[model samples]
Target: MLIGLEIKNFAIVSNLSTEWHSGMTAITGETGAGKSIAIDALSLCLGERAEASAVRPGTDKAEVSAQFDLSNLPLAHAFLEENMLNNDDNECLLRRVVCKNGRSKSYINGSPVTAAQLKELGQYLISIHGQHAHQHLLKAEHQLQLLDAYAGHHNLVNAVSQRYKQFADLQKEFKQLEQQQQQQAAQKQLLEYQVAELDEFALQADEFEQIEAEHYKLSNSQTILQVCQRELQHLYENDEQNACSILQHSAQQFTELAQYDESLASVATLLSEAAVQVEEASREVRNYTEQADLDPQRLTEVENRLSGAMDLARKHHIKPQELVGFHQTIAQELESISNNSSRLEQLEGEIEHALEDYQNASEQLSASRHQYANTLNGLISESMANLSMENGVFEIALTAQNDRAPNSLGFDNVSFLVSTNPGQPLQPLAKVASGGELSRISLAIQVIIAQKVTTPTLIFDEVDVGISGPTAAAVGKLLRQLGKSTQVICVTHLPQVASSAHQQFFVAKEIADGETFTHMLALNKDGRVNEIARLLGGDNISKTAKANAKELIKAHG
Candidate 1:
């Protein structure tokens, strides 16, 4: 519950601190007594948006802080634990500061938090039902949500939502697969022809390089052969001056000298070995010269084979060595095309199974919602009658949509209809009720669902508007009953409603030294009577009105 609130430089509230108690508390004063300003300050602590205009004159900033005792609220503790913002003291403090430059900051448990985090925590702590709450009742979506909450179908709704998301994902994947198959089919015949043509060539991995080398050798064969012939003629082709004849004469001279000295014998042996090696080399050169061939046809064939390989490489944007890998890839693609029909059939089977699962989940969800809708219509009809709508008819109209499966909520579209008079046709809630009637309807629904709501604090901002006499009394009684389980703070103008409060506060505007400010004071027993008397008689508090206020309090007591 909201235990305390502090405000400074916020609107006409320069400085104020208000302490709240359990059960129903009423804030009452004359019109424009800064009653709404107090609520606005509380709103700031509840994570409502703030602006510089909310700051009082001559102040650079405005601040609002609220303290909540979170010892009993497990949800709040869980949220704090999830955010790593847990406090050891079992209390939570929320503060907001708005600067004159239009900047605002929020803090929880003395740690700075983003505005979104503050709002999330605020939702779990307090529920403020203002004049605008009546507007929400006019929306069929809100009504549907309230009914779902009462029926306790949150888990069922989540199950349906999960299945819907799965179905959508599978549908997307199927479409992408179909598109890929279509594109692959269009290129099927072309890829087959290319693969067959490349296979027919029977290209080897190193064949291209070998053919280029052979082509170069054949092109220079004549020059190489002429050079070899000249060298062989100098070494062995000349008569008497040839290398073999010269080496033979040198060996004969060395053999004659070897008889005169021992050193000459070793020199004669080396000359003989050299002569043998030179003669062998001369014979091998003569044999190579005779066998050399310069065939133009073989050279042309080698050149044509190399050119074809190079052209294929360039056309495929690959190196000559990569032709083998290209051929392998084409073969794999051809195989895949041959087996596409089987693969497509498998995908179709999977899709059908997924659709069947989704339909089962959707049908179950729709049936549950139909049951929930009937109960919801009955509950609202009962609540409206209790709120003094004698001839009002409340209903939930469920319309089925085609093909589209259930969503997170259900497949049925729910709309709330109501008739204010017996003979009138039932229409949408927004078109049927006046502002005052809408407020009572909202209060009835809130009272009916208050047991299901887990919020620690519930604030009703003049929900008693446009009610009087016994109806006002009944509204006050209902609020008192709601306060038995939750902390309820009501801002009301009716004396009967104010008199029903377990605690009462008065908001009054004061002008001190030419400065206007607002103050809130918790009223005691006598003070409560005086405030109630004021509300009873307006600006004039008479002795007779005070007596009437006392009688009203006595009657309720």
Candidate 2:
């Protein structure tokens, strides 16, 4: 419940602080007394838009702060906990500051927050009915929403939404795939030709390297043979002074010397090893010199193959090494085209399944709505009669536009119908209900749905406008009754309503220091009497009006 409100430099309210009780708090003042100004200040805490003009003429900024005792507002508490916004006190503070520059900031529990967060948290703490709130009930969309809330069918509605979303997603995917398939079908022949060319090459990872190595040997064979010939002539073909003959002769001399001296024995072993290596090297060189032959045909074949692969890579805008990955990509595209018909068949079946799920959920929701609609109509009709519409008839007409495409809310179109007079035929509430009648209707519906509203505080801004006499009294009584379960706040001009408040505040303008200001004062019994009497007899207080005010308070008390 809202515990208090403080306003500073806001509009005509230079500064005002007012405490509120649990039950109905009726706010009353003379016309232009800034009655709604209080509500406007509260609106800021509720995340309503602010303007620079809201600031007092000489002030730099305007501020509005609200306090709530969340001991009973579990929904609000849970929201705070879930969002990690709670301050651990079970008491929440919301503040809004609007600057003359049109910039605004909000704070929750003294922590900085965005305006949107305030609004989200506000939904669970306070529900303020603007003066024109009743006008909304006439719309079909609003009607459906209210009906759903009253029915407590949120889970069922969510199921329908989930199913509808699935169907929509599947339909979207199918369309995209089908469009792509049609595009690919046009390129089918091109893809087939490309794949055939690649298949002929039949690329092997190791084959490229091997072919290049063999090609190098064939291409440079002439140069290799000349170098080998030079080496062999110097080492073995030098007439009688060849390397083999010298090493052999040297080794035999060392062996003969080693027989005469011990130090020559080591030198003899070294020369013998040198003679064997020289002879082997001479034999291999002669063999290579004999077999060195260039083959142009093999080299040409390898060069053509490499050039072809390079040209393909260039056409694909890729490096020669990237051909493998590109080949795999093209293969997949070809496979997709081949398997497309079966894929389309699979998508069609999946779409059907999604549609079936949505249909089942929507049907279930519709059934529940129909059952609850009758009971809701009967209750509102009774409330309407109690609020002075003697022959009022309230009905919820559910029409199924079944052939319409699937939607998140289902296939039903809800309309609120009303017949304010006996001879009148039931018609759309928007067309038939007068402004006063709409107010009454709105009040009746709100009262009926109060139990379903999770918000702990309900505020009505002159909801009794265009109503008087017994009807005003009944509206007050109903509001007071609602206040018993949840905190109710109403701004009213009627003495009947003001007299019924468990707590009453009078808004009045005062002048001091050459500046005008609006202020609120909580009314005691005598203050209530004077205020009620003033409401009855204008600025003049009369004895009869005072007596009437007393009787009104007595009856309610």
* Top TM-score prediction, candidate number: 2
lDDT of 1: 0.81
Report the lDDT tens digits of candidate 1 across residue range 274-367: 7787778878988887887778889888888888888888978999878878988988988887666676677677767766766777677667
Q: Which digits, one per residue and each the tens of the lDDT, describe model 2 over residues 1-557?
A: 88888999999888788888798999999888889887888888888888899989998999999999998767788878887888868789999999999899999998888888898899888888877879888778888988998899999999999999999998998888888888888687788888888788776665666777887888898888888888877777788677777887888898899888979988888888887887789789889878776768878998887778788888879977777777778888999887876777888999999998998999999999999899999999998998999899999999887788999999999999999999999999888998899999998998788767677888889878888999999888888888898898999999988888898999898888998888889999899999999998888899998998899888897
Candidate 2: 10-residue stretch with minimal lDDT:
203-212
TM-score per model over all chains: 0.81, 0.90
Weakest ten-residue segment in model 1 by summed lDDT: 402-411
Candidate 1: segments with Cα more than 4 A from true spot: 172-211, 221-301, 313-355, 405-408, 419-427
Candidate 1 clashing pairs, residues 3+ apart or interchain: none
Off by over 4 Å in 2: 181-192, 220-241, 254-271, 283-300, 317-322, 332-345
The total of clashing pairs for model 1 equals 0
